[model samples]
Target: MIAPLMKQAGRFSETTVDGEVVLLNLDDGAFFSLTGTAAEIWALIDGARNREAVIAELAARHNADHAAVAADLDPFLADLQARGFLAGA
Candidate 1:
């Protein structure tokens, strides 16, 4: 089966400021901000790339190990999912 694509939640209003992604959740009236590598990861989840593809790109961009980046990526993505920042695919 094909890997699921990652996407931002529709309830969020997002903007990039100084290289960071700022997300406002209209449902909860809360603001979330992602910077540094987190911003990069957030930017990559555009409903087109799968998780592994994102990890690979991040690994190459940081010159880090694929396994290591994948390790780090899981929890960040999970947290985003838990917080309802990600849309179901």
Candidate 2:
């Protein structure tokens, strides 16, 4: 089983305007922009969900295969982790 995600490590707040996604960091003023599939995946990382669950949800939502979703998810998750937007499991 996949481990649970840590929500308390950081906080995320997002806003969409004119088809663009702006994700804000609650701890600091730092923010990032996401587009295309990155935006879709970003919306699914609620921090309450595990890596496996996020991939499963994305696969179902986008009608994609699990392996494909997992492959795409790794780098995105790594970016978020590196940016302090997501915590380690």
Best by TM-score: 1
lDDT for 17 in candidate 2 is 84
Instruction: Show model 2 residue runs off by greater than 4 Å.
Output: 6-13, 24-31
Question: Mind giving the per-residue lDDT tens digits that candidate 2 earns over 1-89?
Answer: 67665533447777898767997888787889989888777667675688899888889988999999998889878887777776773
Question: How close to the true structure is residue 45 of candidate 2, measured as C-alpha lDDT?
Answer: 67
What TM-score quantifies how close candidate 1 is to the native fold? Answer: 0.88
RMSD score of candidate 2 (Å): 2.7
- For all candidates, what are the clash counts? 0, 0
Q: What lDDT does each candidate get?
A: 0.83, 0.77
Kindly list the per-residue Cα lDDT of model 1 for residues 1-89, writing each as its tens digit.
55665665577788999998998887898899999999988878877788888888998898999999988998988888867788653
TM-score of 2: 0.72
Q: Best-fitting candidate, measured by lDDT? A: 1
